[model samples]
Target: MGTLRDLQFALQLKIEELRQRDTLIDELELELDTKDELIRRLQEELDRYRTTVSLPGPSVVSAAASAQIEDKQRAARQTVISEPFIPDAATLAMGSHKSCDKNQKSSRLIKAAFLKNDLLNLNEEEVRAIAACMYHTTINQGCFVLQEGSIGDRAYVLEEGRLDVTKDGQKMRSVEPGDMFGELALLYDCTQTYSVSAQTDSKLWVIDRKSYQTVLMQCGLSHQAHSVELLRGLSFLQSMPEDVIMKLSDHMKECNYTDGSYIIRQGDTGDTFYIISKGQVTVTEKKPGREESIVLSELCERQWFGEKALWGDDIRTVNVIAVGEVTCLIIDRETFKDIIDGLVSDSCEEVQKSNASKIKPDEDPFLVSSTLSDFQIIDTLEVGEFGHIDLVQLKSNIKHIFAMRVLAKKLILHNSQREHIRREGRILMEAYSPFIVRLYKVFWDVEHLYFLTEACLGGDLSDLLKDKGNLDEYCTRFYTACVVEALAFLHCRGVVYRDVKPENVILDEHGYAKLIGSRCMKKVEVGKRTWTFCGTVGYMAPEIILNKGHSISADLWSLGVFVFELLSGGLPFDDCDQMKIPTTTIHGIDRIEFPEIISKDACALIHTLCRSNPLERLGSSRNGAKDIQKHEWFEGFNWDRLCNKTIPPPVIPKVQYPLESSACALYGEGSVKQCMNWDDF
Candidate 1:
């Protein structure tokens, strides 16, 4: 009976222990279930992240729609704490919507900045109009916004991220949000002075030049009229009527001068006239035999100077220095002349109407006082195939020198040739370049066409080459650079100068190269080829020789030959017999041998330029003259000084004033014929 009782107690104990084990197992199962639920939630979150990362940003929305998107984004952000932070489909949509809203806000900021920009001087309505015209663009990091020396067709206002600005490989500064760039393009056609690249993903508001200019014209008419009124307030310009003043205002450019800066030196040639808008300037005259400059006068605000320089005298008689920081409205010589011409024409018309006897009806009232009457021929400079050039001087109070080219109609055999000569005159009259001869006037008599051009007394390159058998590298580079610039300017204007030889390049008194001989020049559209069998034999490119369509590439080829001849003192393909020259040139540079004296870079440049295929030529590249200018041979060359005629030439020609017969004979033989009266055209 006692053993049975003990066994029953042990059974009860075992049952209790089993019951406790069952409870512990149930707890473990519950924990596993919770963990599985958490893992499922984590996987869902990961999937959402992948979706968000892969999805594209929202497209641009209208302003009204953007407001609704912003509200949804706000609501989505508010619900973040209440729900899982994972960006699910709803959250992803809100994120994209937020980006669209951000863009809208950025655009608004850009518009605000434009409104506040002092340079633009825009009114509220004008700002709104310009803002409406602006288009938004986003640039990726490490991408360029503007490149230096590139045509700046659009202005940009940064609304997000930063940009790095550089000039000539040197860091200039950083452009941050709210800053504007390429604004000058809005005012006129200009090249970007600095390169701007994105440092981060950036958003910008861009306004193209055409749109900007349109807005400016619409909004700035009153401002322009105000400027005209300001000009009319000045004593010197007081004589100008409202119409003339309005015309003058269009051509004026505002410039600033710092304290102690020289505006114009006494000896420098002046091509600009200035009217002080602010500050003062001191006009000092150089006292003869004295080191100290004498202060002639002081000009203050509303006063003007440099008027005398525009009367074709050119030379600045006084040194004008800024007394303090000064602002001036300046007009260039070309614009000033145009204004004067208009005024003269109006005056002449009025006078003729009032007194018919003073001006004949058949006579051209514009030519009443002929340019010929102002000039007195001193001596003949050259006798060419169809024309003669003479040294002439202005008989006016201010003596100015010029070279008058006379083309005899009888000498030109073909009517086309006569038209070409006329075209040359027109080209000379219209072309205003430092590298080309400046034409003052063009008129024709019954027998001859007259071209009164700026005299270049230093003679031609052929003479220089003859006197000094071979030129040094520096000399060759200088002259070649000038020609390159001249060609670039002509090419830009669609003019192809088929002839670019040493004989055609005339050196001025300053030893700057002036391109002449426009007979072979033809205006062709860019990328279009001409098939004229023209130009000198040895200098001609293969395409020209074979009568294959040729363009500006021919000029570049001639430039190579010119450089070779200049450096080597002999033509690259010159043969004893003249006929063999064509065959040699047509065969390409295989027969050509470079001298030991020629640098490797120069030889390379020549090879590239003289390639059998015109397309492979150096300057023929899309960059055009810039490619040639940036060549290795031209490395370290001061192109600015070359263009400005500031670089000292290797050889300065020994030219005398009022040249004698011997000096004149250097070009060729010609006579100054007084065939027509001064009044008769």
Candidate 2:
């Protein structure tokens, strides 16, 4: 009876333990199900992210669609919370620039500052538009406008009251009305080097970097469209390409004159052509002997004056006087020189050069005419996006070192660079300057195109910069002079060297700099525009990135960037995120601190060259490159030596190196053959 009772009790205990074990297993499975559901949701998100950010656009997006996209972008930006900047309603205000209640006086003050401001070389219209985007605000006397050593995102303009700039406990300068501060940080997104404190209760106007850029981009688009139509209606400019007209409009400065002001003096040198946009002007011409001028015509809205200037008259035949608070749009003569004449004849048959177009290739002793049998390929020097540069030498003489740029026909066709390839050949044939590399002969095989040219033994400026970091002012000036000369040669021929960067400029044994990488170059006829977006990413000019018509001034912009990099050992618009480079470049260089090594003169030249308005750049004057050559920075620079190749180069490079094997052809000159045909040889 005792054994039966104990077994029954033990069996009941075992049943209860089994039931508890089943309940625990069910709970564990439920937890795992929840985790798996979460994982599935996350996987969907990962799939969404796999789509590329750069979506292809088959057609231009409508303005309404652009607005919607902008709204979404703004919403996305708001999710990224920075510091607590809600000091006032205006300080951290979020919305479109148009939403802000702009202070006219404050905007006028900002515009005035921008006009004289070297960093922001924007024109009158652009300045006015950008200034209106600044929000009006006020701060207490004790508050700091900007804290030292912090990352600054907004620039401020004091409308009223006093402020002081201090660095490391030392007061530097007293801020005045209409003065823009903290712009360096805002433009370049750099750290503030000093602190700004309000000495008295201050009324201020401020614009964050984001808001300023948004407004700027919108303003540019609006202004460009408006200007294009305005230009098209003008009789003298009606035939120009729409894109060219848009570019011309960007360069056009808006000028306001009181009633009865002299817009142009009869005898004064006429470099600028003007189109009256808002009011009437009286045209007067002074005859050779007459002291008083005779009225030629009464010009009103849409009427233009000084049309002859662009076509190379170099003089204003008549005087223009403003009537009733007139506003006029003006373009300088040299800004678009002789556009119609760009396609003039003088192809390969026209150049042997030294004396130019008349000299035959067979007669010129320096010219090399040869067949395939005369040369042998030595080794490959460089492989590029479109081609590879090979070191080749003359067989019989064995000393002529040449860089044979071999391009695969298939690659060129694949990249759709056929026109570019042909244009390069034409340019190389026509171009004859000491700074430009000599193109000896062109060859073609079954699958490749070959350009036999001068060998630059010293490597490119990129390599030089690596070996010698941050070149000094003197060295920079000399190196840049070479590039300037090359630009002058190309620009004079109506070609724009779109890619002007350190990597594209190579040095020879004598340290003479010559432009290479002609892949990004094209002839943008005078007063014409090309919208092909080509060139180095970080070195592209604002107009080029905008896809607005660009010309020689584009090269000048890159030259400024080149100067900045040479002096600072980095680009002024460099960003960690590659996507932001174009955005930063479009914003201009108003905010970055120039390296301590750069001088005021160098800064001035850079500002002049890198102006947002390309037509207003330093070399866009009637004197062309001479204006840059005459800059204070190049005060004593001998341009003659640069052009004549008589200047002493800053660095000499070693030309000799061991070949891949045991033998290599060196260098020789003065060789010619009767046959120019490759097939016959």
Candidate 3:
């Protein structure tokens, strides 16, 4: 009996050991699955990079550069296929490799030289200490050193060999030995702007975010003092706080210009403000009807120019020439504006309070339909010449999606432009059509005017055309019918849509067309016409091009051009030289040669609608949109169903219930604000 009991116990022990082995096997399989998924994602990214880099065009990349790129692509593929760095079971369990102190002194030397340009004030001891904290590593050729959009933790100094740098899959430049890359990642915990890949076997020294921040903190006081000293001499920046000056310095870049180079030219759009850091510049103005430029002022180091552009139209009023080899610290328009806004917020507390009180219970009837406090801005969808279109949601219990159009009040307040804004608001409110983007409300604060309207997730027809090339006849007819109905509604209401093109037509989630852009919609009496040399280059009507009086007929001509562009992949009269478009437009539809691929019926209809004489245009006749609707090109089309959005659309954009980032321009988290004072609006 004792022997039998001992044997039973041994059997139980063996079963327990087998169960333990099975559990280990299950865990290992799960880990392997996870690694496999990671590898698949990496492979997809690599493929996309290869495809974008290999796109053929002389304009895109030189022949020699193209060959080099192809060779790199092959090397990368071979690396992936032959020796992919897959983590083994033991390595996975242990995590990443430990950092060693090998090659420390050499790394310190490389880092010092690499950071010399950016951190000019760093002493040898400070630079060595920063380098001592970095880890040294070597990678084989075709390895990705840093990837764009990846969470960046470290900056690298190349010790040996070359690396290629790319942004959005386009090669920007190459980094040679002793050069540093990925410094921006050290400044903030943001995604990398560019990808760095090893073009050959490379050695690098990398510093993590923690070490970089420590160094910056240690040097902060001196950096701030240096920035403030540089900025104090400038008149416009004199009132700025030390912290603001320090922040501005972070965004500023040093630019060098040779002698006699034009820093800025009169009548050109100014985009950057400059502070002379190391040389002299001369500001000049052209005397009326004179060839010679009169020197207004000669500016030396610490002096500035281009401040007026930040506050207004940004049109340069004077010419600036580099007197010698000049080095300037430059700040772009957006950065300057942000800095100014911050300073204004800090200094203008009293102004904001006064403006707050000025907001009475009663306001302009056309401007305020609902209080500005009721909506929350989600994200900026698009930036326009006059304003920005933002994705917004109602703050009420039932969340509603909407797009808020915000126009700068300063731009609208100009004497010549004020009427245009007023008219746009009025027309949008009065003109109600399903085919047009519906306006829910209009309001304004001290700094900006706002229009709340429906959000179109499918983007614009122009973007769609670019993606799909030219559309099929059925798809073109479906979209055209929607536009025709919208135009018919506008014309009958006595509103002339001066701008009519693919950009002006937006597509909803269901792919239905909606006409937007109220700026060019003007109300006119039946027989009268308005003369404005406005509208896009390629789509401009002959009457508008010739400066002849144009009314609703101009919209018809634009529509015809738009249809042709949609049917053919190219524009009817487009040229590389913009100067030639005006002459070509005035030469009229007779010069338009239709591609053989376009159907005969479509060609005939385009000719009828794009007639040079407004009276002879198909839609401009007594029958109006009815004549175009009955044309052979749109034969058997269901106009009523299309208008009602019951007809199945050719394309439907993928959308989530509230919204998706793909549908709009994504701003950083916390960049958008729900509440704004009158001054900040």
After superposition, which runs of candidate 1 have C-alpha atoms over 4 Å from their true positions?
1-370, 414-416, 659-681
Per-residue lDDT over 206-282 for candidate 3, one digit per residue giving the tens place of the 0 to 100 score = 88755544443334333434555777777776776665665576557768899999999998997888888889999
Q: How many clashes in candidate 3? A: 0
Query: Order of all candidates by lDDT, from best down to worst?
Result: 2, 1, 3
lDDT of 2 at 580: 66
How many pairs of residues in model 2 come into backbone collision?
Answer: 7
Q: Least accurate stretch of 10 residues (summed lDDT) in model 3?
A: 76-85
Q: Rate the local accuracy (lDDT) of all candidates.
A: 0.68, 0.70, 0.67
Residues 63-134, model 1: lDDT tens digits: 658769766533321200010112234533332232222355765776778766544445565666567667
Instruction: Tell me, by lDDT, which candidate is best.
Output: 2
The C-alpha stretches of model 2 lying farther than 4 A from their native spots are: 1-251, 254-369, 657-681
- What is the per-residue lDDT of model 2 for residues 146-168, given as tens digits with 9 covering 90 to 100? 76755567888888999999989
RMSD of 1: 32.9
TM-score of each: 0.43, 0.53, 0.44
